[model samples]
Target: MQVKEEKEFTIQKRRCLVVWVYSLKQLKTLKRYGLIHYVSRRMKYVVIYMNEEDIEQSEEKINGLHFVRKVERSYRPDVEMNFAEKIGTKAAYQYKEEEGFEVEEISTQIRLAENV
Candidate 1:
């Protein structure tokens, strides 16, 4: 008789795209609650939204026991683009002047998760 091997999923950390109206207070909450960290190898963009802060906080609390990695900040362009793509058709767009600056506006708000 042959035995079947069970595959295991190693989920140490999770990525969350938080959406908010932009506020320093919310950002602080995310950091204070340990809901945010630095995803160095995978990314380099810092995303700390308001709505997901609560959920991320809870996740941190739970995962703390297992010493699992929590949320992290990324500031890399590639990561930012990937994040935008993951958000579906939301993100935003930018318009640049022929010889000046650039302007950006939100195309839509598509929060994949209600909480996080």
Candidate 2:
């Protein structure tokens, strides 16, 4: 009996590109660059996810499009996401009350009007 070997699946590293366009009509042309993750119709921006290796080339191509206003790379991958060390630390959770602020009190008593 021959044993079948299972192939190992690997996750590809990807980066997000925030592309701002003058109009949404050119969305079909932008689809060739990367996978569209999100589109903000009101804000006129599109979020695209592409393999990290191809990000630079994709950014340049997308920027050349006349409809595109600007292309920005997402910094999420570079930012540290670990909060384990900060979690439960006093400084991390400390709330400081503002000083020198006073609240004026208003009397709540309502006086009934006497008949004229």
Candidate 3:
């Protein structure tokens, strides 16, 4: 007997994307998921999204579904850059501190809010 290994939950943001399917026949089945953003029968593709927590699991499941060709990760320049900016938010603070400004924590409270 083989046991399936599970992936650990990763800390991240939820993402939306377009999924490509092998055929229109599979489109109906995959569209059953409400998260599907849209489906293009002419192009033979579907768009869907889910929280980051479920992304890994979903990709596996979706790909395993019959006639699923691929899940396309959509690109959003603004969103990606914003995330990068969030991670680098303290960069300017360090520069200010180096310029003779006293270093201090503006807010000690840890906020997990994605929107700044």
lDDT leader = 2
For model 2 the local lDDT of residue 37 reads: 90
- True lDDT of residue 54, candidate 2: 98
Model 3 per-residue lDDT at 37: 73
Comparing 1 and 2 on lDDT, the stronger one: 2
Candidate 3, position 52, lDDT: 61
Question: Quick one: ranking by TM-score, best first?
Answer: 2, 3, 1
Off-target runs (Cα >4 Å) in candidate 1 are 1-13, 33-116
Cα lDDT tens digits, model 3, 1-116, are 99999989966566776677777765556655537777787888877867766767777788787787777665662344555457776675465445576557686877677956
State how far residue 27 of model 3 sits from its true place (Å): 3.7
Instruction: Give per-residue lDDT, candidate 3, residue 113.
Output: 75
Model 2 misplaced stretches (Cα beyond 4 Å): 1-5, 87-116
Candidates in descending lDDT order: 2, 3, 1
Residue 73 of model 3 has an lDDT of 64
lDDT (CA) for every model shown?
A: 0.43, 0.90, 0.69
- State the weakest 10-residue window (summed lDDT) of model 3: 76-85
Residue-wise C-alpha lDDT for candidate 1, range 1-116, written one tens digit per residue: 99999999964444454222222333444464444533332333334423333555654553443333343333342354455567654534544457566569869867777655
Candidate 2, residue 110: lDDT? 68
Cα deviation at 19, candidate 1, in Å, is 2.8
